[model samples]
Target chain A: MGFEMFAVFPGCTLEKYSSELKEPLIKILKYLGIEWIDLGGRCCGMPLLLSGDSESFREVIRSNTDYLRNVVVITSCAGCFRVFREYYSGFMVKHLSQFILDLGFSSFPHKVDLRAVYHDPCELIRCRVAEEPRELLRRIPGLSLSEFKLNRESSTCCGGGGLVKAIFPSLAVEVAYEKILRELPQDVDAIVSSCPFCYLNFKDAASIYSLNIKVYDIIHILGMALGVL
Target chain B: MFDNVFQTYKLRLYEAMDNSFIRAALRRAVDSFRINRDKALKRYSDVEDKRLRLIEVKKHVLSNLESYVKQTMESIESNNSYAYYAKSINDALKIIDEVIGSGKMIVKSKSITSEELNLNYNLKLKGNIVYETDLGELIIQLLDSKPMHILSPAIHVPKEKVAELFSKISGENLPPDIPKLTMFARSFLRDKFFKADIGISGANAIVANTGSIVLIENEGNARYVSNTPPKYVVIAGLEKILPTLIDATILVEVVSRYASYYMPSFVSIISGPSKTGDIEKTQVLGVHGPREVHIILLDNGRSEVARDPLFSQALYCIRCGACLYECPIYQLVAGNFGYTYFGGVGAIWTAFIDRELHYASLIAFTCTLCGRCKVKCPMNIDTPEMILKLRESIHSIKLIPEPIRQIIENVKKYGSPYGLTNRFL
Candidate 1:
């Protein structure tokens, strides 16, 4: 297989809220010997599209298209991945989980013992990337992944999408809290997902509700397994 | 204007959230719905195929809705039933008023269309006594509250609250036991069913070919409501029209399965008034059941929605309400997220049927635009897509909430919704 350079699009949520996931994301890419270029900090027009400001959405799309027109775009943000995959036609886009799975997980040299459950973000589920993240998690040494009763296509939202957090903050947090209470396995040490919004929402929900579980971006766990975190 | 809408919605949402009973009840109901729907759907391997076929049939019927309406009326008339097309809520109310007259007793099954028409209020104003037959609906009727869920209207009300309400109605101390409460309601409503001068119901599907009104229900109240009275009326949306009885059956099955039932206890198919030839081999009406059957197919902006290229797909909804349980926002706030209708699909229905885009504007924004509703819908209505289209229309009219408008501005100007000047490199 030939190593190809891809452009990394760190969507606004990742930059603002879950910036810690960025370092491990870069570390995993480096360990995999993949060359990448940062597309710089930018919005993926998701907010505009969600807000029904299609005119501004188109404008943002045009601006981003100029920079990303010729590259295979990779992003850890599920919202960005969904926007590019569904809306943009001229370029190819892959969620970081899909990108990593396609690159293959050949060897696992380090062990981080933990029992975790994988949350399927609404965007990744819409994009049909449910299995790739789970497959990646299974490859890590000493990490066990369990399934939510409602997983994949049936997975519920993390209550962080469609600007809900910005407008109805309490409702968003309540949704996340209900999901944790109802869906999270009692024995799991952590909940993992690739989407930055899910990461931020779950993190906030767990802390606010005094839930003792840890929340992690899949990259963080993967980086741990590969000795890159 | 935007501020008022948002504030009103926020207030209602917070009120619903503060009610811990409603929160707990909603959680239990949502969990059960999920489990039951998954189990019910798993029994049939061809669920997807059936759903697709129903979608095709719905699309075909909606495409030629005017023709189907004509055909349905003709077929219904031929079956010795009166058929009327109501282009608006006022027209439907007028027709209903004329049929039942004043000082009449009426028993009604769960009809969201009637809710749309505010049928009970209008009929009561005309001096008619109206009773809701479905237990949940009866609960709502007593509470003077709107439905909390499309299928389970009073799901937000806990058993203790129901016992209290029923206790007052029964003039006795009714226990909080489910069976006792149910029996009390049954005995209480049973007399109304017999004494009622008219029965009204909403059809799950109306077969154009056979002129049959198909209704699926678990409580058996609809059977009494449609049969016991001397006159019966069905007020249903024109979108319920199906080309044939077979298509209607398939649709009913899909509706039941997605509504968390393998099959409802009663699947009533009524074509026309009850008649018999037992006397002298000559067919005579008014035998055992209602002698007069009136079918009113309501348009009320359904035709306009059907003509819209972007939103026409919304008419494909079977009203299974699988989406409401699946909706993250609806799970938290229940029916506060909508106006007349509730949940993501309700936003579209509110905008069109209720013709209140101002209210629908806030409801549309309440949705997370997560595709859970679409994935769960047997009709695959794409409520999120419809909501986006509705939002666009609302935005053009400058009905967007201030927070959303600011976010959009920030995304356009600062390249981030947060409007941060510093970039993470």
Candidate 2:
């Protein structure tokens, strides 16, 4: 993928988090022998669209859709999945984990028996992308997963999104605290997440707040199984 | 405050607050708010529409607040109620202090504005007997804690812990039952309401046409707080003002149904102090609903908000707090969403209004940059854009952790932050 991958950012991945997962993501894809063409998309426009700026949102999406043809769009953010699956229905969308499992499961030459719980992103479940990640995770041998009590239809939001973090930090933290308090297992060694957004946000939650909890990206874990290191 | 703001960000706040006693107190208080709010929302079918209409009304009100507040103040005076328009939090706080002498008993109902000013602690510091009458607020008060949720102040507290708090605070053997907890708070607050000299509340909507301050709540306390006291004061955010009574009426329909509530048991519309055209058309203001009503119209940076183009758009928020429940990061870490403000949008506002207030640059950085917060926001505040601006500001200052900084620098040089080479595996 070229710089066009930057468009998924709207403005975020562009400026603040531009470097996140770039190397790990690129290395994994290359190891999996997957070809990811940029297709020259604009900013995912999720941010602009979410703000009720439909005009800017439409303009950005129109530009993105124009460049795509018969290629599966892979991204690690559940937010991007929501926009691609529903907003731009023309392109096939999958979180990077699913793409890796589909194209590179047999390419794996190592084994991983890591036990962890998966933190579900609200969008993946709320917007109905729930089962795909689990199906993909199952394809990897010796991957033990735990279930959240409030999973799928009953899943609660992570509270990291919206302007809550910006506008009302106290209330937003309260919500995140609730989810982690309820969903995270008491004895789990690590938490795995498919969405990069959820992955990083939860890392902050676990490392800074809980301190004892551990977290990892699904792609990062899968890289071990594929002997891509 | 600036010296210590970043300290809170770097250290784990929740673990610090996670003493066994404090944890128990939070668990007890949060459960009842959830149950009551759930029951309220269950009674309504068109909650989504009501939420949308409410969002639209808030946007319109903020857009036209200058004219609406003038009209509202005129109507309030025409009806014998007084409005003290103040341009800042201090201005409003001073107006309240000047009117209500210190050390008097003050009864407060549910209002996020009260929390925003840290009003209870401020009042208590001045030797006033302050009683928070709202059930959730009462529980929090007993614990000497700040509110955890806007609509549900004690949402972080589960029920069993509330029972434990009740057993200790009230000297009663209350079990962990939710109903018992409600009645327990009610039993204690009922006496406070009648004997209290002052009543303080927050308005859901201040109708300019009718000069009415609308109090919508599932509990009956807001009614008693407004109606029973001799002196009633409303400390309302400027965004609460709406154009017409009919517009507000549509909003009452929405607010009652979808405060993430079923239908509020009580929707109090107090146009003015309880007055009567007794004996020959002469008006008398004394009766019920307070002999005197004072509406303190607070700016607290709202006017500056109304003036700006880039950030002013978010001033349209109606404080529904629904967006928190729909968030991803908010769901984790329970109450630690990340300090004074948690979650995505709060971080942006914290950064914009005063970045010093929320030093967690992590709160802004941790957002997966997902637009979900905007979708969940009733006003649809563009959180992603705001977060980008916040992160840009934070990164520019190099407040980023050293490891993350090295990552970004690597990405700058090698086109990948992980410091990986171009070779496959």
Candidate 3:
């Protein structure tokens, strides 16, 4: 398969707390014979758009689209995938899950026995980029997936959207906590989601609520299974 | 605009979130509505097709709004009913005052259009004895609370609260039995229905071609309000017009499916007045219902909304609370999210009507832009899109909050909202 080409957009979260998600991502891509280029430090302009700064949002969108106009840009963040696909139409954008699902990994470096419920990020669901993450999660051996009663398009928010975390952090956390109490599977070992924002919110809930469940980005779980984390 | 309202919004949001009774009621109501809506839609082979047809009809009428308004007025006049156009809230109230003309006993059915004008408050301030007839609306009126939902105005109130409220009103310590409480309200309102000189109602759809107004409800109070009084008045937004009775019927079906997931128990189609041709084939206006019918078409910034290409889709809303059932934020906040109208649709509508953008901003900002409202809407009104547009418009006027401005600054300076320097090499 001639899958040796794509520009990778590792969004801001991957540069910070989710940096661990990258090494395994790279290893898995390499194992699948995919060649990727780092698109460098740039915001996808979602925060600006959500926060009522249209001029800067425009500038960011213009610059990002101008840079990636010719190449297929693969994003590790679901928000980046949404902004690029929906707003900046100059380039073809894909979530790394979609790219990986297309490339097809032969084996995970190690098997992980994980019983997880997938938390669909609003951006992923709205952009219809939801199933790729679930399919990728299913690729892991000995991992069983259960669903929240409200899943896919109707999934409860992680309370990170529309800059709520920046504006009303407590309210955001409260919403996240409620989602956990109401929707989360009682017997699940972990909650896995694809969006970094959702991952952060869920992580906050897990800590503040002192729940004994691990919250992982699908990439983090894949990284553990690939023995690269 | 954004800052002043944010504090109150936070407090109200906290209160709403803390109230377990309201939360449980909202949860159950939304779930039941969703399930009922789904099951109801299963009867049709193509709900989307019907929805698209309705959207087309609405768009056509909105595009030709001026001519349609004129036509509707002419039809009402020819049918021996009076029609007047009110350009603003004060203008609508003035028309209502003129029509009622010092009438003391007044009864009103559930009308969100009336709520937008604050008609009841204005009338009460003017010393008219006005009673709300619809059960949910009457409950909210008794509690002196704003409506919490479009269809179910008192959805946030628990049975115990209603029982206590009724006990105080009727001087009887009523149990929380729903039927008994309903019986109390029915008897309480029955006298007002007959004793009133004027009945006020809202039109769901004004059929321009036939000069008929359609009112759909489950409570049957609209029928009493429109029929029992000597004088009847309909206060409706100008956008509530359809080309013909057939279109109105289609709208009734669409609204029923979306509002509560079943056909409403009552539909009142009043053409002009209570007319009788039974005597000698010579028509007389008053027989059983109101002798004089007056329909007031209130503009209230609808012309501007119609002129807007992006936002005019908002007027296509049939007041079906389907989006409310689908909305996560509205599920939490109930009607506290808006000033008059609630949820995303209310935010856009209030932005157009309310000058204070403070209340509008607070209402609009809480939306997460999840696009679920659009998915749930039969007309597919892009509520989240309209809200973001409202934000952008208010931003252009420099009304954005300080925190949001700082967040934008942080994103600009540090490529992330967290304001951290790049840690990845």
Candidate 4:
């Protein structure tokens, strides 16, 4: 397969939601000219792990453990990146955001000229994920970022967790938009997240005509950067 | 009326607080209230088990409320007590009128359903004298105000105002000393037990099999209200029913511990108005309880809630108000943040109970959604998430205002949230 898996999407990424970020992910790969095996990466299955369904999750981990051998797992999601970095053995996982920064593509592909508040999704900051996304975004020329009064571990949930969506969908959107709208500086462009669940939930909430903030995944920002439609 | 409801719940709470009397009165009760809950839960080890059982009981009742209501109505009728299901608030008031007719001095216990139905004002218009026997309720009644918190009705009223109320109600110039004020009210309400013709109370839980209405209160006013009068009316929201007395008893434990009762304070299980059949089991009303016991099972907004998977859990709330006290944001703003409901979870409730509220969206944004309230909530109500869902409904429903809609449109088009000119640009 000779694939250089540079990143991974963590479990519960619900990757089906984003067609916008795929080609750009591939384009950035094409620009860097690295082999990207986008699929067959098993879900980190952390949602089940956190919910106390570790037996099934261990089975998943065992099955996926073989795939990561001798290959780098590249992920646009910080959650996936954190899982591989912290838990999984015999795999290489680098976050797409930091990878772009390392590749100097944060400056090269496109400059998304916006002053926005970057939110650290719960798992991304308090969990094993690195602070590299923040470090990388700050380095990107002309990408102005402001900190929320409360972020990182102190950051709020969008109310879209723990199978809360299937059980309670309205609450997911309600709390997501609430957290998104909180800490508005009276002047800011939008809210951005490293997690796709947060990104998508916040995006749907943003579309609801009550919240005035836009939501974006980091890969989408990179999509804008890499000049892939 | 809907507009005033928003004012009463949102704006007026702050306006009432500005006088400092409300704040002082609230502080007087708040500490004591928090202490009771802390002490009670500490004493009870199996409290969580009880809560879980209660949750299971409530789940069964809510899942099969239609059949349970049918069962409850039949049993009460057999026991010579009457049952009327009011699908709406108006219907409940009308049914209440058939029982009361006119010229009645009512000694009622605490009923949030009655408050929801606005029955006191309706009955008062019909020229009936109504006195609230629940100590907390009495304070709110004397103040001519609404409940600020669920358990403590006059939680917003400070002691100075209570002193003034005691001075006016008792005709004795009393100081704002909390014990003194409480003693005065106790003496005053102890007398209302004997003089009232009709007693109206709310059931904490109702058992379908036995047709028993369970009341859990610390003050025993509910017991007096249900027992002393010739005719007693139970006006409960339809969501209160449980399957059996055993299940209802388990819920009583949860309610007591979570509501901050050290021991099961006073559990009154009234079955069909105290009817006793001696020789032939000829059920007689008004033996140990009220002769004519009428229960108005209200639907008003509960059934609409039942249709939605999201908001239905709000009905599952056992009226514990533990969520309100545990809320960090609620600790700061109290009743002002949300409407009559209060706090982040209350904002979702306000939307469900009444849709026209404007402050709900404004208040919804106040929560950090730290998930602490859900952590403390015994039911695991997931209020933070519920608030978000309500926000979505409010935003996308086309019923929201245009400016808010424009703001949402900006999020989809630009990556920026506020539609601002990018400072980096």
Tell me what fraction of the real C-alpha contacts between chains A and B each candidate also makes.
0.69, 0.11, 0.44, 0.03
Grade the docking of candidate 2. incorrect
In the predicted model 3, the residue pairs found to clash are none
Local accuracy of candidate 2 as per-residue lDDT tens digits, A169-224: 44345555656776677667777776655666566666557666667777667776
Question: Model 1: per-residue lDDT, tens digit, B1-425?
Answer: 65886887798898897789888998899889978988999997577799999988988888899999999999999999999999998899889888989999999999988889988999999999999999999999999988988889998899999999999977899889999899988999989999999999999999998899999999999999999999999999999999998898888788888998988899999999999999789999988899999999999999999988878888898888898888888887788888889888888989988989888888888887878998888887888889888898888888888899898777766788888653423
lDDT of 4 by residue, B381-417 (tens): 8776676566565554433333334433432333122
DockQ of every predicted complex: 0.62, 0.13, 0.53, 0.05
Alpha carbon deviation, residue B353, candidate 3 (Å): 2.5
TM-score of chain A of each: 0.95, 0.82, 0.92, 0.83
Candidates ranked by TM-score: 1, 3, 2, 4
Writing each residue's lDDT as its tens digit, candidate 1 over A1-229 gives 3544599987887666544876677777788887778875788889989888889889888888888866889998999999998888787898887887777666578997989999999888888888888888888888888989889988889898878888888888888888999889778999999898888899899999999899998878888888987
lDDT of each: 0.88, 0.65, 0.83, 0.67
**Where does model 1 exceed 4 Å of error?**
A1-4, A27-35, A226-228, B280-283, B423-425
Q: How well is each residue in B79-162 modelled by candidate 3, as lDDT tens digits?
A: 899999999998998988888866489999999999888889888877788999999999999999999988899999999999
Best by lDDT: 1
TM of chain B, each: 0.97, 0.85, 0.97, 0.89
Alpha-carbon DockQ of candidate 2: 0.13
Worst 10 residues of 4 chain B by lDDT: B416-425
